[model samples]
Target: MREHYRDFLIRNWEKGDRTRAAAVISYVLSEYGLGWEPNDADRDVLQVEEFYLATGGEFWVIEHQSQIVGTGAYYPINRGEKAVEIRKMYLLPSVRGIGLGKYLLQQLEAAIANRGFQQIWIETASILVEAVKLYESHGYQPETGVETARCDRVYVKYLD
Candidate 1:
């Protein structure tokens, strides 16, 4: 289904979306001083098919004026009971504070729950202040032992 956000369209991943989505993710990471790297946790960005969709998870891309501006995605993880990890939830600075992040997150949670996932987890770096705040405000209580190399914080929320 197609979802809209103030002229932006939210849609599922397509083969053609790989490059645009990766650029969005890389841009956002570099903008935050995180500089996208081809590491363990981030390998998913380069392998969206195998990492998310092919694994039974979902990925979304948001475009405005025909330009990709943001991305959000998740994949099943082995952390908790039937758990999934939120990943690549990034938006251009121009789109921040406009509720897109919250909207994407709510959509992800709903989709995950509908798929029978029991919990959601996220790994993020403290440098991403907006992301950290968004997760906390959405009932994702902070957790310890973050395993993502570029991340120092972990948060988890139960769907049940």
Candidate 2:
């Protein structure tokens, strides 16, 4: 499938978007056996909301004809870090393999770069081969750091 690119407005997520965001998070979490069983908790949803309100992070929804097909976010790291973590990337199953994920990542990286961030980092499960490939293809490489036993891999890219 071919994906047509368009500028998705990045904005502060509203409470009403919580349900849709939860669905996206749930689908992703379950797809990778993240131990987040359905109806178990709204932890992902609450985290997203907190990320927005606490760190002033930004989220972008990949809207096709006014429907949210995917979502992603960028959040700050620390004082004078000039870096951010790409988090909660998820796309509908129908949109997978359509180049939409790549386009969304590109836009997200560009958006962060435009904000003057110099580095970007992302963590993915070992089971998520597709996501790992996407990050590697986009120049993200495995990094040595505080290893997350729960996460199989961690990647970083310097946007110099």
Which candidate achieves the best lDDT against the true structure?
Answer: 1
lDDT of each: 0.88, 0.71
lDDT, candidate 1, 1-160, per-residue tens: 3798778899988889888888888888888788677676567877888898889998889988988899999889888799999988999999888898899889889889999999999999999999999999999999997887889999999998
All candidates: CA RMSD (Å): 1.2, 4.3
> For candidate 2, what is the total of clashing residue pairs?
0
Instruction: List the pairs of residues colliding in candidate 2.
Output: none
**Candidate 2 — which residues are off by over 4 angstroms?**
1-12, 37-44, 47-49, 146-149
**Structure candidate 1, residue pairs in collision:** none
Candidate 1 residue 130 C-alpha distance from true site, Å? 0.7
Global fold similarity of model 2 (TM-score): 0.80
Q: Ten residues in a row with the worst lDDT in model 1?
A: 34-43
